[model samples]
Target: MSIKPAIFLPELLRHLFKRPVTVKYPFEKEPVPKDFRGNVVFDPPKCIGCMICVNDCPAEAIEIIRVSETEKKFKMLLHNDRCIHCAQCVDSCPTKAYHMDSEYEIAAFSRRHLKIEYK
Candidate 1:
């Protein structure tokens, strides 16, 4: 098969002068849009330990732990790896303890590090 240099020459010349379209993702982060579901944020003080979030979560990422006999001292553990970011847990919370944050940069090397604890 014969190689066509004429067809490739124009594309190569155009790319040489044109500026790159890709943004520096690691250095420059684009702003997250409104109503963007990134990650789960749990407020320990506002949480009533109702277990509503735990039941509503489709991913089963939310786990409620009993700190003592008192309901006020309950703790919550959220596994980010298992979470699908569907915002189901946030909607189910009556106290508005669970919320979705704008920050989406959640890359991690280990699964253990992705787990968030709320007390």
Candidate 2:
């Protein structure tokens, strides 16, 4: 066996001269995948003020505050800042009241605004 010279080069060169396939983020947003885990949404009617989500949340981000017109029912309050997106609340919700949405832009200057009542 004898090898005088050896050279290996990629055949495609047009891609180098072409515009970038990547997007400029913050200014531009790429489409989220069909199964991406982003933000959470709560369905007030579906939830029976069950404590399953509150109990199961590893982050302890969920709280159920019952409106005491009667001891029977109340609204659920969720703190978005305390949530770590573990999806525990979603998984524990028996009525499918909780779900993850594709909208991940949940940033805010005040943490209080992040808290939302299930309604």
Candidate 3:
């Protein structure tokens, strides 16, 4: 069958007079939802070296390291480049050390800039 441009004409006309539904992003931003998962926020002090966040990440983007072997202090590294932002780390963390951030503007010039280490 041949394509018809007229089929879309009525739908286009109906929306033409109405105010634009598109947002003026960058200039203005819509508020994120209360439970929106944007990025990983790690609190070093709250972490108990459980390594559950590291093990449970589906993307394998997170790493937990021992900062001090004698003191059991741990450090966490979040590879945002590989992160899917599923908030699995937040859910898996028993100590509430990991939480999702609200900021969605996660763009970076380089991949290296996306890697975040928490100590």
For TM-score, the strongest prediction is 3
Off by over 4 Å in 3: 1-19
lDDT of 1 by residue, 20-63 (tens): 99989989998889999998988887877788888888999999
lDDT of 2 by residue, 1-119 (tens): 66434332232454667788888998998899987777778877676776888889988888777666655455777788988988888888998988988888899999988898764
Local distance difference test, each candidate: 0.88, 0.79, 0.89
Which pairs, if any, clash in model 1?
none
Candidate 3, 1-119: lDDT as tens digits: 97587998888899998999889998999999999999998898888887778788999999898889788788888899999999988888888998898989999999999999988
Clashes of 3: 0
Per-candidate TM-score against the hidden true structure:
0.78, 0.75, 0.80
Candidate 2 vs candidate 3, lDDT winner: 3
- On lDDT, the leading prediction is 3
Cα RMSDs of all predictions? 3.1, 5.2, 4.4
In terms of lDDT, model 2 sits at 0.79
lDDT of 1: 0.88
Deviating ranges (above 4 Å) for candidate 2: 1-13, 16-19, 68-73
